[model samples]
Target: MPVVLSLNIAQRTVPVDYAQEGATGIDKRPVDGPLDVRAPGPKGTAGSGVAGDAIADIVHHGGEHQAVYAYAREDLDWWQAELGTDLRNGQFGENLTTSGIDQTHARIGERWRVGTALLEVTAPRIPCRTFAGFLGRTGWVKRFTQVARPGAYFRVREPGTIASSDEITVVHRPEHDVTVELFFRAVLTEPALLPRLLEAGDSVPPEIIDLVHRRTTVQLDS
Candidate 1:
């Protein structure tokens, strides 16, 4: 059984030279106990899972499609060596740091029950300038992209409280070939894999689904 290694939350803080106003919740630290998990309302609405958790950059951070972010502890271990730095649970900006789970290969639309809430894997986090800025590493975006273990974002299906050490069990997995890694590669590294994303059906987020549809339509028309 996969387990939640840590429950992390952060208050907004503007670290010097962070390049963004307000605190980037990326510097999340582990909390002592159970934390509420719920949808952050609509896309434009701002909300946080933990009571004091902050989402400073609202535009790209919150919403139903990305309510909670999960990163594998193993992946963090991998980065520890690569970056020669100590990384804790929320270091990657993930809400839930998990162990014994292969987040990269998790099929899109897969459902995992953590504590009482049910979460469905919605999309792979695409690295952005904000993430690179957080790390403050040279060529970090490219380097992170190349590693291709970008953590998975999950939408809350059944809202409830989750605590550290709670068992994470897979409840459902859609029949699809579009794993998180495949989706990442399809969009960022290999455009040719775009069509394969269609296999995941409704599991893929609307934004990605639309993008893939538009691209495939163009290819067909040509």
Candidate 2:
């Protein structure tokens, strides 16, 4: 249940230095590390929500795992066009990008061991305004939603160092037929899938599951 591949990293604050990276300040964090990560505050950034990690402008962060992405091992000239050019060459904001597995199928509570690092699938990323802006389209969020097959985010369950090209081995894949993508889709369109999502509710975060319930309510009313 594992399809290991290479790994890489890049700075997200390009064209904007620590001084000019704006309020968000680049949003940089280690690809795989413990939660509550911090960094050295940017100049004059006393309380700019930027963690004071060793890295400068270590702001604009997320929870245990800020970002995640997936791709097929082979060249993605075609997949690139669909996901936009920013992620075609594996240069997106993703912390871990690899091939050989159906990432959307990674259910909650599932875990993987890449090199020595232990990662657990937390949830599918909810497309945000930042992502829409990064791709330069107001409808980018909707487009991404239509596809809704993005990889799953992983919490660094284990703290260990891993180099690029390490194999990703899947240690578990529970009895979750309703994948992350399916849940995302049901929340988006299908009302019938709501029950399944609700049945598997415990596996998903309460906030997200609550959102699905909200949507179901609206659809029922309509």
Candidate 3:
């Protein structure tokens, strides 16, 4: 059974050279209390789905589509071994650190009943310079992209309180095979896979759908 290993939120913003605001909330820490989860309106106006969690980069982070971020503890452990360092929950800026769940292969549009909240998988967390700078690792973006286990972003469907150790139940899964891993590859590395994303239909993020359209138009013109 999959469960939320930790419910984390940014305790304080830390100054960083990479963020546009000169600070970032990437250094999240686990919180013991339950958090109210809800759609934080739209990007630029919204912050984090979890109440009290901070999103310093409104232009690039947060919103309904990316209302919440989840990362598998298994993946984090793998990184811990690979980097030869102790990695903790929410270290990757995820709101939920999950265990016993394969977030990489989680299909787009999959619904998970977490606590009393219903979350729908929407997109993958793209590696950014902020992430690289936070880790202080050279070529971190490229390295993370190469691995393609970028974690999962989700939209809040039913607002509720979620706390650490809440069980994660897969209530629904879309029929298409466009998993989070595939979507990451399609958007970042392989343009050929973009067309296949259509199989997921409207569940595919609008920005990605736009990319697909642009590619299709360019190919036709050529």
Candidate 4:
């Protein structure tokens, strides 16, 4: 049974040189009790879906599409071994630290009933300089991208509260093979896989779809 091992929130922002604002809320920490989840309007305006969580960079983080972020504990464990360091839940800035689920392969548009909130997987977490700076590691973004195990991002379908240990039930899955890993690779690493993203239909972000269309059209014309 897939369950949330930790419900995390950014209680405060931490100063970081990598972020545009010179501070970031990437240092999320686990908290007890139920946390409210909701569609936080749009990017450049909204912040985190989880109550009390912070998003210092409005231009790049948060919004309806990235309401919540979930990282599987298994992936964190893998990173722990790879880096030979201790990684606590929410260390990756994920709102939910999940167990018993493969987030890397979770299909886009897949819906999960977590506690009372219904979440739809929307995208994968793109490695950023803030993440790299938080880890204080060189070439961290490239290393993470190479692994292609980026955790999943979710948009709130039904607003509610979620708590640690809440069971996650897969209530719906789109009939497409566009998993988080596939989407991440398509958008970041493999341009050849761009056309494959079309099979995901509207499950993908409109901007990404547009990118694929433009790229493919340019290729045809050339």
Candidate 5:
């Protein structure tokens, strides 16, 4: 059993100062330290256009892994084991933090119970220009995209109030070839990753799948 270092839940508004309309510019700014958990999204609330769990868009807050998140608490703690990190807020640049279990072996279509909310792991966050800002370097986005460690997103199966440090349990797991890690890796390196994600997107977060489809389209057009 892994321990959840910390738990954080916030509201996501929209029209954030840096997060824009399109997929290309969603991630911006580096969030630092922790803010009140009562606010929407991480740190503070955003605009109206982008609100919810699937979109924990971060901008200039933390330093290590800005805008990182986990839909299921099990995966959140599990990933801490795999990453060998304490799941610290400022350390990992994680805007939204969780504790419970690991997510290294989790996949899409998987179901998890966290507190009163039941959710399914949807898709991985694909790094972009905004990610580079966290590193304060150029091309780091490409490097991170290459490693494919983007965390998981869960769709609310049963909606309820979710508090910090709640217990998470797995209800179902998918029989897919790709792990969450592989999905992130494949999405960035292999064009084939798109087709698989597209099919599974039905169960994934629409925003994330939309990103996969958008990137695939960009690749095709290019």
Candidate 6:
């Protein structure tokens, strides 16, 4: 069974000297015990965020579709090798650092029973300038995009508390061709593949669906 190896949250946003926003909530720290997860509002809009987590940019971060970000320990290990550095849990700004699961391969709309909260996989986290600044890596945005192992975001279906070490069980998986890996690649690399995202129906994150629709509209007009 997959388990939550670390539960993390940040109370205050960290200063990102290079970003125009000046601060970022990407610096998350590990925490003990349980944390509440819930839908604070409409699906596409920002939720209150994890009980103790502070999301700096509401325009781009937060939202019901991205209520919680998750990354696998395995992926982090891979990055560690590439960067030649040690990465602590939550270093990637994920609310949950999970073990024994391939998060990138999780199908869009997949549901997981995490602690007492039920979460549905919605979309993939897209790296940005703030993320690059946080890492202080040169050309980090391009590097991350090319790596294309963007972690998955999930929406809270059943509001409840989740703690470190909680077992994660896949309760449901929709019959869809869109996996998190494919979704990331489509959104960032292959605009033509955007139409393929429609197969997930309403399960695809609304924001991404809108993007694909917009791209399709542009193609038709052109």
lDDT for position 198 in model 6: 88
**Collision count for each candidate, in order:** 1, 8, 0, 0, 26, 1
List model 5 lDDT by residue over 92-205, tens digit each.
333334444556567777777655656666556665554454335567676556545566655555644444445667888777655677667656677566667655546654
lDDT of 1 by residue, 1-222 (tens): 799999888767556455465456677888877988887776557656455677777667777778888999999999999889999889988888999999999998899999999998988988877688888887888998899999998888899889999999999988767899999999999999998988877767777889988999899999
Model 3 gets an lDDT of 0.91
Show the lowest summed lDDT stretch of 10 residues, model 1: 13-22
Task: Pick the winner on TM-score between candidates 2 and 5.
Answer: 2
The total number of steric clashes, by the backbone 3 Å criterion, in model 6 comes to 1
What TM-score does candidate 4 get on C-alpha atoms? 0.96
**Local error of candidate 6 at residue 154 (angstroms):** 0.4
Ranking of all predicted structures according to TM-score, beginning with the best and ending with the worst: 3, 4, 6, 1, 2, 5
In candidate 6, which residue ranges exceed 4 Å CA deviation? Answer: 42-48
Clashing pairs in 3: none
Comparing 1 and 3 by TM-score, which wins?
Answer: 3
Model 6 RMSD in angstroms: 1.5
Mind giving the per-residue lDDT tens digits that candidate 3 earns over 111-217?
99999999999999999989999999999999999998889999899999999999999999888899999999998999889999988877666777898999999
TM-score of each: 0.92, 0.64, 0.97, 0.96, 0.58, 0.95
Using lDDT as the yardstick, the better of models 4 and 5 is 4
* Runs of candidate 1 exceeding 4 Å displacement: 13-23, 47-51
Better of 2 and 5 by lDDT: 2
Which lDDT value does model 5 have at 148? Answer: 53
Supply the global lDDT for candidate 2: 0.52
The clash tally of candidate 2 reads 8
